[model samples]
Target: MDSDELREVLQEAGLSPYQSKAYVALLELGTASARELVEASDVPDPRIYDVVRSLEDRGYVETYEQDTMRARAHSPADVLDDLQNRASRFEQAADEIEDRWEQPELDRHAASIVKRFETVVDRARLFIQEAENQIQLSASIEQYEQLRGVLADALDRGVYIQLSIYTNPDDDVELPAEEQLAATTTEARHRPIPSPFVALIDRQKACFGPHEDALNEYGVLVDDRMHEYIFHWYYSSCLWEICDEIYSSRNDEPPIEYVDVREFIRDVEPMLLDDLSVGVRVVGKDVSTGEERELEGEVADVFYEGDDYRGTREIPLAQLAGRASVTVATDEGEFTVGGEGAMLEDVEAMRLTITSASE
Candidate 1:
């Protein structure tokens, strides 16, 4: 290093400019009188003694009395040790930061607004490994391939997986083969237009990023169950339902189960409106007492504020945002059922199954 650069490094290493200059001058001289050090280092003559004394105190120099105060540089062992230790600590801290950035659970926010969509998607890959019951996703075909490995693992665990994938009509990108998609997803659909990337896990966690071509680029990581419910509807109404089905491991037969109450509502609402009997088994919690309930009953009715069903078979997810419920009549009594994060109903349904569908 040059003399000027050496001086700056010494200052950063906890030496004052005066101390650094005095030490450097003394080092070259082997030993120097106060007057000689002041001339060599450009330190003031009167300040030379005090600067040498300070360097000596810090173990960078040694002082002796020879007619007048004289100083010489000490071995640099201690200073080198401190600098190396600091460098090691900084390296370790950098690794820890990168590790936390890759894992969504390591982040403390229940709902995080992030600048990079890459960060949101990377963490979403980690969250997919933890899925227990379901996975709802919307992505570009390339983004789907990026997550397909972890998604395949989720599928192997019997977690229900649905994907809505989009591609630019002009881009000549090949889609994943049907068998490749079937192995990773329970159901997959092709969305004709590009949309935001979304991943919702068991109605408890969600990750979202704006479409790549959006003017404002941003992402959200949601850990709160109630907060994630909103994203679930967004995926259902805008991404999933409207897309054309391309693959399925689904059967519209009886004994069908639903992890999301909104999807259950969409399918059965028309039957209720048609005055047809639908048998259901609801696994849910009482809204008032928070006690668990497994209700086997007949569908009594369906309610959605500001919506007129008119016996419509296709109920868009938006209508369910209002005070919505599936009423059930059991041997005991009638109970109002609502979806995950439900507040207004008698019970919050975690899973609803259609046991029978009548003629």
Candidate 2:
């Protein structure tokens, strides 16, 4: 636009201040001797020669040894091509930044830190859709609504859904009724206070975000079982356990199913202690081989770290934090079954159903 701005553009394009001035002066002069360039550019006469040589090296100008050393600006064709290429690169880079912002790439076996909490919730849809046997979720009422349809689809597929929806206690939010929630989730809870949005799917993948009102907005996407384990506990103790169940479509009678070992232990531990026979069928992965397997048997024994604890509503998540397993007596033999991603057991259970109960 202006002479000063044009000079600035040239300087920003890798020309030194003096080179920019000298080149601009040469272009206006059409063809100039060293003395003429010094007069037009206002560059110190002593530095003009070296500046012209630098411009010549960059193909911005050409110099010839004449009666008094003549110099002239180059055709500018190559310079225009370079600028166009740079513009294209900048445009491509901008698009890539937007794409990555919208869908942050997550590592399959590690955590990926993402910029926005919304990104975590949005990406979690696919994980929720792929849920095989279990899903643990905590959401704001809005977030819950956003995921309600997918959760309903998963429920129709017989995936165990545990959801906790929260809002500020002061806000008189019209919460969903039990009848409405039962269609989407197996169990749902409500928190009168704010909580982070968390989704743990099939004990293998997790999406975690800070409270929506947090000053810094960030989230974590985890595909690691160990990372998922930590997120699972967080969801359990803070979000799910204390909250009162608002809606449940759980089958309260025989043939009750549990996707979590801790829950399985809680319900069936009482039956086992009562000397009632609880028959179970477990679908899970083999601990040693990581292959999917289904095992059916009668409950043999229940084991955990603490002797005083028999899994019940009163038992805290911390109590269930240590080793907990179900030993089943099949026709083949008695084998131990643990929770999802269970490392120290015979099988990592995805779902365990009490197929029969006998007095």
Candidate 3:
């Protein structure tokens, strides 16, 4: 490499300017005294000893004592190995510290943003490794193009694979490079889902995103075990079961038309409402009095009188900020009640829980 590039690399390797120059000089000259080193390199005389000592401590240099002290630079391979080892140690320590301090929040937001294909690809890679028994993938031609390699890798390792593709009928379907790798080693199959999102990876991970036209607008990976479990319940037990029946009967028709009220609500509201408890606020003028009254608490029930118009009744709690309130529990004392509007706002910001302090 050129001097400029080498210097930049040294900087990345955690070397100071003078240290890099001094080390490079030693490398060229083999062995040199402090005076010779100072004259040959850009390092000043006063800082030479400190720089030499730093290099020696880092195992990049060896110092010899005689009438005059001399130092020799270590081989590039040895120096590079030492630097890499030190870096690995630092990274392991940092990961431990972060695990203790930031893991809870880190896992929550790791796949929230879908800025680039790389982020989704990485999440898919992680999911493949985490998958113990099964993987279900549904994606557009474009998404599958990016994820083919990850799927193939998982299949090679003996993980069960089931993939569904959503593409135009005229579009040519081909496995991604990675998927091709696993195709020979694992069970691989594909079908079509009308929707563009992909959701299958054992019961541990799920990647949901937009169709081709809206690709840049939405994408998310759910890695949390609790979230994945809930999704599996709905997808496997409810959605996929009916989808299987439809496929077997060659009924390529929309299944919602056949679903009962309970299934209809589940299909319409993709949001898992079982583990979810909602808060509601009613703001209206009392019919008996001319005064305005607001009632807010955990939503006991939500009923719709007509399309686009919904009514909710919540147990009254102490009033808080505008139309919001705090529910006082018998044992837990008091906790703020956040309504559906607030929940929607939170979701847009990539937040999952209203109880988050940062929100």
Clashing residue pairs for model 2? none
lDDT tens digits, residue span 30-76, model 1: 55678888889999988877887787677666654436655555445
Clashes of each: 0, 0, 5
lDDT of 3 by residue, 1-359 (tens): 45555555676668899987887677666667899999988899999999999988886766655357877653344444544565564344323322322212213422343333333554565666666556766555566656666666675675545545454556666544443534522322334444545565654477665556563654566766556645555544433433322112112222212111122222222222343443323332233342443443342322222333122122211111123222312232332322222231111110111211110
In order, candidate lDDTs are 0.77, 0.80, 0.47
Candidate 1, run of 10 with poorest lDDT:
95-104
lDDT for residue 175 in candidate 2, whole number 0-100: 89
Off by over 4 Å in 3: 1-111, 170-194, 233-359
Ranking by TM-score: 2, 1, 3
Write down the TM-score of every candidate: 0.66, 0.69, 0.34
Q: Model 2 off-target regions past 4 Å?
A: 1-105, 310-314
Show the colliding residue pairs in model 1: none
State the displacement of the C-alpha of residue 70, model 2, in Å, after optimal TM-score superposition.
49
